[model samples]
Target: MTRGKLFEVAKELLNRELLDKDKCYMLDCHTEIFVWMGRCTSMTERKSSISATEDFLRNEGRSTSTHVTLLTEGLETARFKSNFVNWPKKEELKLYEEGRGKVAAMFKQHGYDVKELLEDDHEPLINCRGTIKVLQVNSGEAYLIPLPDQSKLFSGDCYIVQYTYPGKGRDENLFYAWFGRASQMEDRVDALSHMYAIADSTRGFPTLAQVYQDNEPEQFFSVFQTLIVFKGGKSSRYKKLIAETGMPDETFDETKTALFRVQGKNSNNMQAIQVDQVSSSLNSSYCYILQTGLSVFAWIGNLSSTEDHELLDRMIEIINPTWQPVSIREGSEPDIFWQALGGKTEYPKEKKVKQYIEGPHLFAVTLIEGRQRILKEIYNFTQGDLTTEDVLILDCQSELYVWIGRLSSVTSKEAHILGQKFLEMDILCEGLPQETPMYMVVEGQEPPFFTRHFSWDPSQAIMHGNSFERKLSLLKGGSQQSEVSVRNSWPAGSRGGTPEGSRRNSISSNGRAKSASPIPNVLGVISCTSENQLPYSPSPAEVKLFAGSSPQNGSSDDSLAFASSPALQPMVPPDNVRVDQVEGSDASDNLSIYPYERLKVRSVDPVTGIDITRREAYLSEEEFREIFGITKTAFYQLPKWRQNKLKMSLHLF
Candidate 1:
C-alpha cells in the first residue's frame, strides 16, 4: 500500500468520533481497499464499468490487466474481500456439480452437516448453494450464527462472501456469513489487492487525486484539518488547479482551492476541523454531540475578564447587597478564582482559571443561607473534596431543587435535578451524577465513618466539614444522622429553618451557595417567596399532556407540580442587543435577527374567541385584549397558557 494513501486513510478515520481502537483498524483496512482501487483506476480508460472491476476482484489470486471501476463506498473490508474470494467462471458450475460427492465429502470434513445446505442466488458461473443463519447484531456490527456446538465470532473478526455481476445488484452475489479461517482471509486480501491493481490500471484517478497526494502528511492529514469530499459548486475547477501544480506543490489560492467548510459532521460554528481528531473511531460521533451542545455556552463570560467582572459585580451588588462572601474550598484549592472576597493563593498550583471549570459567572439565586449551608455540607461530604467548587441556588421544593455548580466527580440527585433545570434554561451541564455512590470518604477516612451519598443532601461526614456541624455538635447524631432525612429549622416565620421561600437552590463546584436567596425584584436573584399571590390559578390536570421531550429521554411526567409560571417569571433588561448600520442608518439602531419574537400572552373574549384554525390563530397582547372581554391590564397579567403562548411565539420567531 502507498504510505501516502495510508496516511490519507488514517486522516479520514481520525476525523470521525469513533470510541474504540478496533473501529480505527477496520476503517483503515477498508481505506486500503479503496486506495488499492484508486491506484488501479489511475491507468484505466475513464469510462470503465463498475461490474468489470468487480469480476476481476472475484478472480481470487489471479493477476491480469482488466480495467474497470467499482462503487465500493460503505462496504466493510472483510465483506468486500469476501466478494472476490470465490469468483465463479461460467464453466466451473458444471464441473462442481459433477463432483457433488467431493463437495459433500469436503463439507463433512469441515464439520458442517450436509443436510443444512440450501439454494441461494446464483452467479452466472456457479449455482451457489449455502445456508446463512444470522446470529445476532449488537451496537451495529453483525455476527454469523455458529454451528450448534460452536460459539459465534467476535466483533471485527467476522466476514462474509458474496458474488455479484456489475449490472446485477448485490443480491446477485452469493453471500456467506461464515468463512474458513484467518488464513483464508489473508489469501482473499492478497487476491483483492492484485485484482484492484489490474482493474485500476484501465481507469484513471478521481478528479482531485493529485491534490490529495501532494500535500505534506500533516497538512493533508492533520488533527486540526478536515477531509472534505467536494460534491458540487466549483469543485472541478479547484481540482484542475491542484492538478496543474501537482499534489505535493503548494497551490494555496483560496478561489482555486475548494473551501473546507465545517458544514459536515462535527462542524461547530465553522471553526472545528472536519476529520476525526482522536485515533479511536468511537469518539467520532461524540465529537459532534459535544461540539453542538457546548457551542451554546462557548461565548459565556467568566469573572476573569474586566467586562465579565464588572457584570458580575453589578449583578451581585444589585441582587444581594447584604450577602457576605464565604470562602469554601476542596482539596485546599479554590476552583473559582477571584470570588467577591477571596483571591488566588497560588498560580496553577491552587487553581487555574478556565471558562467553565472552577470559573465564576453571574447567576440567579433561589435558596437562602440556611438551605444553602445544608446543601454545601451535603456536597462536600458526598464528593470527598474540600476545595474548588462553587454553587448558585435557584429555587427548591420538598423533593426537588434547582441550582448550578461546577462539574463534580460525584453529584447528588439534587445536583442532577439542578442539571435538569439548567437544561430547561438552555444551560448545558456536564458530569452531573444520576445516582449517589454507596461509600463516600468524609475528612479522609475509610469504611466506619463512610456515609451513603444523597443527591440533595450530603452525608453526616460532610456536615462535620462545615462550621455549622461543628457548632451543633451533631457529628454523630445517632439514628438521626443515619436516616436519610432533611432537617427543618423550627422557629416559625424566622430565618432559622429554610426561609418561607427557602429551598435548597443549587450550589457550585464545591457545593457552595450559588446565590444567597430567592428574593424577587432583585436584579440577579429569583424569589423564594412571592409577595403577591397568583390569581385564578388553574388546578394542574391529573392527566398529563406531552409538553415536550427531553433530548435524552422522551418520557412525559404523569404527576406535574405547579410553580411560578413563565409569565410570572421576571424578565431582566437585555445586557446586549444586535444592530445593523448602513450609510443612512446606524447599525446600533437596528434590532436583532428577530425582534418580534418575544413571549407575550394574548387573551380573547370567550364569545368572540380565537378561531384556533383560522384568522392567524396567534394574537399579540394588544390583539388579545381587543378580542377578549378582559381589560388590557388583566390580559397582560393573565398567567398559565396565556403567558406560555406568548413566550413560545416570541422565542420561535
Candidate 2:
C-alpha cells in the first residue's frame, strides 16, 4: 500500500479499537502513533505494512519483534528473538474490555451516562432524558450538541456533554454543559471522564475553572474568553445559588432586561445601556441541568448583544422572574469584607486640649487657682518639698490668694499660691489664726522690719547679747545675780564702766561736747556720763534695787523710783560726735559682745529711745499698712493671719 494509504489504515485500526474498548487516551495520540509508523515503514508497500504492524504490537508490549535469518550452505534456521512481534492476544483484548467497563461504571457513579454511537446513526441533538450525557468521541457518529447559551465554542472542540433532569415531559426539562476545546477524540474522552470524576467528588459540576477565570480576568485574560452564564426554568431552584454567587436581586430592571456591560481587564468605562429585546440563539438548543438540580447556561459573547437580552427575558419569564444577573457592587458593606479579611477601616480623630496661656490677662483666675490649690494641697498635705512658680492660698471653701512668677526661685511656702517674684518679699503668709497681725508687701516695697524707724536712740542701744542678758536678769529680778550684773555694778571709773575724765573730756572749754571717742565702747561711756552721773561706787544692793524692778513683776512704786534714777535716763552722745558717723558706722564691729555681732542696727532718735529689738515692738498689720501706705481693702484681701503664721513657723519673724 502507499504511505498515505498505510497511514489511513493505521488510523482506522486505532479508531476502531478505541471505540470498541472505550479506553482513556492522552492528547497528540495521532502524532505519536503515526510517528512510530513512519519510523518502521520505508521498504516495499507490503513489507512496510508488516513492519508498521509489528512495531505497534511491540510498542503496546502485547508481543515481541520477529526476525528470520537465511544461511548460504542450505542449512536454514528460523529463530525467534526476545523481540518477536505478533498481533494482540485474546487475553490483552479482554483486559482492555474489562477496563472500559470499569470506566463506564465510574462515569455512571459520577452522574454521567456514557453512550456509544453507531456508524450510520446520528447522535440526538436534544436532551430528552434531562440527564448528563457524555458522547463517546471515538465513534464515527459521535454527538455534536451545540454550545449552551452564552457559551463560546472554539475550533477543534470534541467533547459534548450534557447535565439535565427529567421533567413533566420531554421538552420541559432543563439542560447545561461545558463544550470542551480538546482536539483529539482520546483527549476529549479523558477530559469528560475527569470532569465527571471531579463532579462526583465535589458534589457539583466542574465549574470552578470557569468561575476562577471569571474572577481573575487580569491573570487569565490572554488564555480564555470570559462569559456571563445564566439559567432559568419552572421548578428551578436557584435562590440560594444566586445569593451565594453574589448576584443582584432579580427585581433589578437592568438584570431583567440584560441591560448591562461586562467589564474585562482591557475594557474601560463600559456603560450599561438598555437594548431592545430579541430571541436567544442558544435558547432550548444548547442548555442542560446537572444532577445538583442547577439549571445553567451562558452567553458566549458580549452581554450587550440582543441575543443575550432576549435570553435574559426568556429566562426571567420561565423562571418566574427569579433569575438575575450578578452585581459586582452588591453584598455586605465593602468595609465588612475588608475587615473580615483583616483590613483596617479609617475613623475620625479626637481633638487635643491647649497647654499654655498666651495673653496679658494670664490664666483664668478661677480655674487656675483651683488647679493650683489642688496641687499645692497635695504637696502641703504630704509635707513634700516640691515647689512651683504658681501659688494658691485656699481656705475651706475658696482661694484667698493666687500669684504666679519666675518658676525657679519659688519657696515651698509660696509654691502653693505665690511665685518666685515674691521670694525676696515676705510671702510666707498662711496658716495663722485670724486674730494674728500681718501685712502683705508687694513689689517695690521694703519689709517693715528692714525700714529704718527713727523713733529710737542709737547711743543708748545695747548689743543684742547684752540686751538679752539684761532682759533675762530684769525678768528674774536682780536678786538672782550673775556676771553681767557684777560688770554693770562696778564703780563709775572702773575699767568696764564710765571713765573719770570721759565726761570732762567730752565737754570742751567752750562748754560744748568735745569730739566723741572714736572707739564705740568709749563713746558709749561718754554718752552714758553725758546723760547721767552715777555715784562713784554703787554697791551690789544698790545695783539690785535699780535692776530688780521689771515691767512684768515690779510694783508701780518701784517702777517710778527706777524711772526717776539718773542711771536709767536715755544716753546721749556729746555734741562733737558726728551723727552721720554713728548712723553709718558698722554697729556689729563696735558691738562685738554678741555671737551675731555682724548684725546691723537701725538708728533711733534720742528723745523716744524705744527698744525696737523687743518682740512687742515688731511691726503689726496696722502699723505695716500705715508704714507702707497700703489700702485696707488690699491688705485684707491677703491671708494676713496665715502669712504671719508661716513666717513665725519658719522663724522668719
Candidate 3:
C-alpha cells in the first residue's frame, strides 16, 4: 500500500459516523501491522503492532478477533518503527537529547519557554491527548494558538513518541511541536518551507535570529504582541479577537469578520493575520499574515476577502516603502493619516494686499484728521509751474485740493492710465466722507479756457466736474450773451440753458446798476448828474478826459483840463481823482498789453438795456465762488471796495 492510500483510509475512518466497539483499525507497514481499537477515546492510546504471521498463528482458543487492518503502507520496517516507536542506540539517543536541549535553549532565549503537557504515565505517541505550552518567559502567558474549530488554544499541540529502556521508565525519544489548527497543518508546513527558502538567501531573518542568539528574550515577545489574528466567517470571531487582544473597537468589522488598524486609531503599532475557509468541497483554507508597520506580508493560497488586507498592504508598500510604525498615545483619536504622509500642516496662509507703481500722473495717498486723502499732482498750464503757485488752498481740511495745470503734456494713454489710477485711489479712499478736489487752471483764459474743476463722486465711481466753457459762462459778466447764444443754438424746448423765467436780472428796474461794480459795462458807460439824472452823452471836454485816460491805466493825461470841466467836476474829485480805482493795480501796473482789451465791443441795446459785447475773457459763477469763496448774494452785499478787490483777484476787472 502507498502513503497516499494510507492517508485516504485514515481520512475515511476518521470521518465515519459510527464504529463497532469490538472492531479494530490497523495500518500495515511492510514488517508489521499497527492496530488500534475502533472506538475513539479521550485517554492516551497505545501503539500496538503484530507480526505479519500473527494472524495465521492465532489459536482457535482466542475468543476475540485481532484489530482490523484499515490502512496499508510499503515502507522499510526500521524507518516505520523509528517513526512510531521511540527506541534508539545510546550514542544516537545522546545526540538526539543534546539537539533537543539546544533547540529548547534557543526558544528560551527568545522569551519562550517550552513545557510538556503530558506526564510520564501517558504514552507520548499518536492519538495522545497531550499538548505543549509555549509560554512567554516574562509574563508567563501562553500564546493564542489557532485551533481546528476557528477558536484559539492557549497551548500548542505536541506529538511525541517515547521508548522504554531496560529496567528504566519510559524515556522520550522523538518529538514534534506545532502551533495553529490541525486543518491548517499544510499551511504551517508551507510557511516553514518558505522560511527555509529565505534562510538560503544572502539575507535571512537576521533580526529574528539575532534576538535569540543575543539572549534578548523580552524583545522577542514584542514581535508576537504586534500580531493580530482575523478569523474569517459570518460570526463575530473578529470582535472576540479584538476584545481578547485589547484592540480598539473600531478595528473590527463584525459583519465581514475582518480587522483593520489604520495609522491613527488607538495606537500606531499593529500587525494582522487572516485565516479563511476558501473551499468547502476541498476542505481547504488560506492564512495571511501582515506586518503593517513594515508593510510585509506572508501568506498561502487565495483569500476569500481580499479587499481589506491584501490591497491595503500592497498600497502601503508602494507608497511608503520605508514607513515605520508611529508610537501614538493609547487612547488618542486618529489624526488624518494622509496629511502626515504628505507632510502638510493644518493652519491656513495669510492674505496679502495688492500694490502698484507710482508715476507722475498718479495720486499721492495720505491720511489726515482720521480721513484719507488721495492727492493728485495737478499742472497749472496758466501758471507755468504748479510749484510756483499757491495751489494748496485750504490746508488742514479734510478735503484735499490740487491745482493741475492744463494737462497739455499728458497723452491719451497716460490720461487713461491716470484715470484708472484715480479710480483706484477713489476706491482706496472710500473711507473718507468728503471728496478730494482737482483743479485744471488756465489763467487769463475765459469761457472754454477757464479753470476746470473735478471732484471724486463716490456714487458715479468717476471724477465728475462741470465743463470749463459752461461754468465760465455761468459766472462772469458775459453770461447773458452766452446764455442767448446757447438758447439760440439749441432747438426750441431743448433741455439746455436756464429756464426762461429762472434768469436773474443783474440790473434793477430803476435803470441804475443794482450792485457796486455791476457786471463790467464793456459796451457803454453811465454818468450820474448832480441831480441824480442819467446823462445820455458826455461833453467835448468829458470825451477828451475819458479818451486820454485809457481803461487799462485808469489815468488821463489831461487831468487839469478835466478839472476845469463843470460836467466832470461833479463826477470826478476836484483833485483829478476817479472813483472805483481798480484794486490789485500794483500787480498789473507793469503790463504793457492785455489780451482782453483787444476784444471788439458792440453797442449796448437802448430798448433792452442789454450789452451785446462779445467779451473774450471772464470767470464763471463756480470759478468766482471757488476763488473768493463767496455766494452771489454775499458778493453783491460786500462793500464796493471789497467787491473790486475780488473782481481783480478773478482777473475780471
Candidate 4:
C-alpha cells in the first residue's frame, strides 16, 4: 500500500473488488501491464507509475514491448472497465442523458414536430461504419501515416484517429486523440490541435476524445481487426534500425485463434466482445464462442442459461454457417478443444453475480416528426412513462423489457435493438452482466411481470369474467339456438405466476424451461340458437355518455321506454310474437326481459377479445376513433377484453 513500491493485489481475471480507492497496484494482464493509482495515493507513485511498470515487468522477465497503461482509480479507461462482470456507467450515461434531455426538451417544447429537419440532414448511427483514419504528429505538426491495417501503431508518437461515416457533414463523427507512452508534450499538443482542426474542417461535426495508446477501450479496438503495438515510435533512436531491419513486425494468424465473450440474452441485444484467445479469458459466469480456423466452438459455462446455447447456435449460423459447431460444456472440454485455445489454463471457475447497486431505470425511445427516433431517459418508471407512441426501455436490474406502444411506428418494433445500441453507444449499461435477460412486450400483450413495474390498477378486465353470461341467466329471454361465452385468443396468465394454461409451448433445446411473457386475453365470437334472447339494454351510464342524458328513473322500463327515445323509434313485432310486460314491477328494477321484433342481437365478447363492432355500428368509424381517442385499427387489434373496457369507458354499456 506504500506509495514508492509496487504490489500485486490480485492476479488473473480481475473484478471491481480489486479496485479499492485506498490502494495502488500494478496489474499484470499477460499481454499488457497497467498501473492503477488510487486518488489517495501519493504524488510520488503517480509520477513513478511508468517507471515502476517497466521495472516491475523487466524483473518479471516480461518482454520490453509489453503494452503498458496507467490509470487513475476514478478515471479508468474502457479497457480496464470491461474486465469486471458489470461496470456501472451511471455517471457517464447520466451525463449523456442530460445533454440529450436538453436537446430533446427543445423538440418537446416546440411540439415534437421536427419533420422539417431535412431528410438529407438525418442518418442512422449505422452510417458511422466506415474506415478509421490515423494521423501521427511530427515537430508540432501532423501527417497521415500508412495504416492499411488498423494494427499499425507506435508508442513514441501521439495520434488522432477519425472514425467517419457516410453522412460526414450531417452528424458528429468520433475523433480519438491518442497520447502515446513515450510521446512528448509537444506531440500531445500537436495531436489535440490537429484533432480539433480536423473536426472543424468537417463542419465541426467530429468530437474529440483523449485516449491512451496501449489502453484503448473495447469500442476503440472494435474498429480494428487486431491491434499490434511497437515498442517505440518516431522519437526513439532504434526507430531507424527497426525500420531498416523490419525487426519487430510481429506476425500471427489472429483470425485462426480468437475468442469472444457473449453478453446479454435473447439474440437481439446479445454482444459478442472479442477477448484475448487465451484460457484465462474464460469466466465461469458467462458464455464464449471460440474460433479455430474454420471451426467454431461454443463453450457453454455451467452457470450460463439455456438461452446461451440458443444464442451461440444462432451466432454460428451467422458467423460460420457452413461449419457445424462443437458444443463443449464447461467441465467436459475435450483435448482438441484445449489445443485450439492454446491450453487449458486456470480461469474463474465460479460464477459471480455482482451485488445490486442501483434501482430500476426507465428510458423512452421518442420518435420525432421526421421518422427519426431519439432515446431519452425518463426520471421515473411509472404508469405514465408507458405512452402509446414511444418505446420505453424499463431496466429492472436483472431483467429488461422493451415496451412497444400500440400506436408506435413499424420502426419502433426494433426497440430491443435500438435500446441496446443506445446503451452500448453511451456506455450506459457498462458493468451490467452480459447475460442479463431482455424481452419485448407489445402494448396489449404486456405480461404481469412487465406490468408489475408500473403503477396501475390490478383489477382484471371485467369482460373476461362470466358476469355477462350470468346476467343473461337472470333473464327470461330465450337462447335456445345460441350460447354466449368468451373465447380468449391468448390466456391472461395469473398474476406473479407462470401460466400452466393449455397453450402450446415448446421446451428449449437444452431442456431447461425458459421463462416467458404471458399473452393477454382476446375475445371470440358467440353462437346463438333459434331461441330469441332479449337484447342488452343500455345502462344509465351508457345513456348519459352516448345520448348526453339518462332517462328519468332509468331503472324502470317505462322510464327507459324505447318509443319515446329521440334517436330512434321502437321496432314493431311480428303477428306471432307476443308483447310481454312485467306486471307491477318495482320502480327500482331494470328491464330484465322485453318483447321485441324477431330476436334482438348484440355481441359482447370482451373476455376473448372478439371484434364485435356491431354493438356500436350506429357511430361511424371516424367518430368512434375521434370520440374514444384510439384509431379504429388499433382498437380492433386490441384484445376483445381490452377493447371492451376502452369502448365501455368512452361509451355506454
Which numbered prediction scores highest in lDDT against the true structure? Answer: 4
lDDT of each: 0.24, 0.25, 0.25, 0.48
Error of 2 at 636 (Å): 99
Per-residue error (Å), model 4, residue 429:
24
Decide which is better by lDDT, 2 or 3.
Answer: 3
lDDT (C-alpha) at residue 472 in model 3: 30
Best by TM-score: 4
lDDT sort, best first:
4, 3, 2, 1
Please state the error at residue 240 of candidate 2 in Å: 8.2
In candidate 4, what are the lDDT values of residues 90-181, reduced to their tens digit?
Answer: 42211122323343344345332111111121112233356778887887777787765444566666777887644312332566777766
Ranking by TM-score: 4, 1, 3, 2
lDDT of 2 by residue, 1-653 (tens): 34423233332224223311211112123212111211122224323433444455466564231221111111111110111133222111111223334433543453321221111212222222333443323332344434443222322233333344322121111111233222333434444454444344432111211111112212122222233323221111233434577854332222243322233222211111111122221112121111111222223231133443444444333333444422122122234333322443331121111111100111111111111111112111110111112222222110122222112222222222222121122112222222121111111111111111111222122112222233333444432222211111322110122212222222322233323221121000011122122112211222221224322343233221222222221112122311122221133233312111111132232213323222222334454344323433443343433222222212222
Clashes in predicted model 2: 34
- Please give me the total number of clashing residue pairs in predicted model 1: 68
Residue 182 of candidate 2: its Cα lDDT? 20
lDDT of 4: 0.48
Q: Residue 451 in candidate 1 has what lDDT?
A: 14
Clashing residue pairs in candidate 3, if any? 378-404, 379-404, 379-405, 380-405, 381-405, 475-620, 475-621
Could you report the Cα RMSD, in angstroms, for every candidate shown?
36.0, 53.0, 51.7, 26.3
| TM-score of candidate 3 relative to the true fold | 0.14
The deviation in Å at residue 544 for candidate 3 is 99
